[model samples]
Target chain A: MDDVTETDLQAYVDGQLPEARRADVEAYLAARPEETSRLAAYRTQRDALRELHADVLAEPPPARLVHAAEGIRGAMRARLARWGLAAGWIVLGLAVGATAGWQLHAWNSPVARAAPGIARQAAVAHATYTPEVRHPVEVGADQEAHLVAWLSKRLGGSVRAPRLAGFPLVGGRLLPGESGPVAQFMYQNESGRRLTLYVRNEPGSGAETAFRYAREGKIGVFYWIDRSFGYALSGELEREELYAVASQVYRQLNP
Target chain B: MHAAEFVALIPRLRRYARALVGDRASADDLVQDTLERAWARFHLWQRGTDLRAWLFTVMHNVNANRARALRVHSEFDEDAPEAQFRPAENGLLELRDLERALADLPVEQREVLLLVALEDMSYTEAAATLGIPIGTVMSRLSRGRERLRVLMHGPQAAVRLKRVK
Candidate 1:
């Protein structure tokens, strides 16, 4: 056996040495009386130290320790509750922000959301036909009741040919709109200046709107939206003239 | 870890605590502090490691912090090892001398020596628990074992031996 170092001998007492080293330590201890006595003394120290306080392990743990352990679980549960509440608030905040975004976008974008296509068609149709010499009216004022009835049936809402104090009904025609067909009714006065009112339903999902005006070159247009349908008046005239005509359209449609 | 696991660790903690502080009540206080700390920092403990060693390390640290904060190193205080001297029910003189010698060890040596000699922890485990190097554990163990031997049987121990013999 190699000379057993103190560490190896201690390892034997600690039961930490591998078997080969431990056997060597055992043989080494068997031969040396002085080292053997030292080993025995160390063993006694270990035993008395253990015997001195070994009973402590069998004693029941104090109540404070038990309560402290329970406190850990309770604190974790409270933290989880706090985290759950925080997550709930985050979700609610996202929902509110989304709804607010929708409401703001709804309230602020009427000019952008207005049925520009319908109004443009009105302007284009007026521009297309105001210069024509004939065929300006497809079904003339003689078929006015039939015109209103057929147009209303197609548009899914009332199509009123608005009254202008100077301009009487010239004629009415059906034009294609974004969702379905549109109705354009023409009126003319002594100087032959004409105005067209375009009406359609099923344009877009929107709430009520107010009278807003736009101009396509010299042609003035006044447009507004209600719960279900949209109306636009197009004519080469003063803004006041078209406003008056659109107000008349609005009042009659609502009435 | 479950409550049962923590419960299982309690006795060992108390034993180590009593070994370090050498008093039952103070040792229980140390165990309570260790448990409270372990509960708070349980997540920081990695699984698949020695939980007992981890708990011992926590108790060692808690005891150290309390000692430093209170500046109270009740090194062999009167009530502790002296209490073991009341002529044992069988008057085991040798055992009484051994207990007194153990309590007389320096705090650092007792911490390392008891962890190894009594708790039967490996040197590496004792080193890790006391946040010292393994070589340091060995040196402290050697010094502590030698001090305990001299105190138990040196010329100064003649009186104890005569009483026992």
Candidate 2:
């Protein structure tokens, strides 16, 4: 009963055995000291290897990878702005040259600049607040009306709570903004993985709207500027899941 | 796959790259190259097939090309083989020591070993990923595991093998 071949034992260790052979393999292992020790060694080796590299998956992918996924959106936006200025100039029947000049100048000015990192900030806020066992959000989802009214009032706009598919509104909190007040909306799945929508009013964000993407570690953020408001959605999920949630938020707000 | 879906695989690719190259800089470069290559040829990737397995196949081919350019060969230390691999009484090898042993494994053995052990791929998946026969994958895994145990047990690990006359 102990004539187990080396490959058969290897298959057993690797979990490649048929159900019928499992008992025979177990019996063979029970009778053999040397083979048992080796199997123990193999399993331990596998565990150690996994432990050493498991952290890699936890950390975020680098910014270059994020930019690659974004597919030249920034470059295209910068180029399209000039043509847009020309079109807006003639369509609105304003001072075409002057408006075009101001638009071009505004593109260079601080009005178009939002300090380059609302996405990272959103990701950080989500990472910090989402894990809270007691106080994840300042105003719970139970106070949905009050939370929206207060946040919108403070930001001087309508800051609505988004209802994403498969993720209910868990709650929300008021976070200190880069300049003024910021509102963070938290949503959670059944598994406890959270998604956060961060919004704050930035006067310098200009009237231009752009969809931007950034990844911080395992977190993926789809952030955009719509007129004076900067909105971002952060989640640990991969692209497709996060995009679905982002689309929901965008539609709810624009509607 | 969508670009974002490709982005999601970056971490897994990076981890495998680090394991394969045994250095951070080279691994990062390898990952970047793999992503670029995958993106360029993403249309070729049929949907519904396992993305992870397909990615591993790409990585294996990329690694093969890189190794061929470097003219690298798997020349493991051959001073002692069967004698050094005999089971020892001690079972308390350090994890760090095991990692070092893993790095010392021959490249071919290490690849199959990691595909099976670290990545937990089935033998069929692993063979397809490496573009090798299932038998070759099994043999390499067997050799790799033995070598890793002996190395972790320390350089002089040995016990008498029983023989019947």
TM-score, one value per model: 0.49, 0.54
Model 1: lDDT equals 0.71
On DockQ, the leading prediction is 2
lDDT by residue (A1-255, candidate 1, tens digit) is: 656667787777677877878778889878877777776777877878888777888888777776565444334444466556655555666676756555544444553444355667678877987776688877899888998888888788767776777889987888887677888888888998888887778456354443555679999887655557777788988976676777666766666
**Looking at model 2 chain B, which ten-residue stretch has the lowest summed lDDT?**
B156-165
Candidate 1 chain A: 10-residue stretch with minimal lDDT: A70-79
DockQ of 2: 0.21
lDDT for each residue of candidate 1 in B3-30, tens digit (9 for 90 to 100): 4467677888888788778778898888
Model 2 Cα shift for residue A179 (angstroms): 46
Candidate 1 displacement at residue A104 in angstroms: 37
The DockQ values of the predictions, listed in order, are 0.17, 0.21
Give the Cα error of residue A208 in candidate 2, in Å: 30
Lowest summed lDDT across 10 adjacent residues in model 2 chain A is found at A68-77
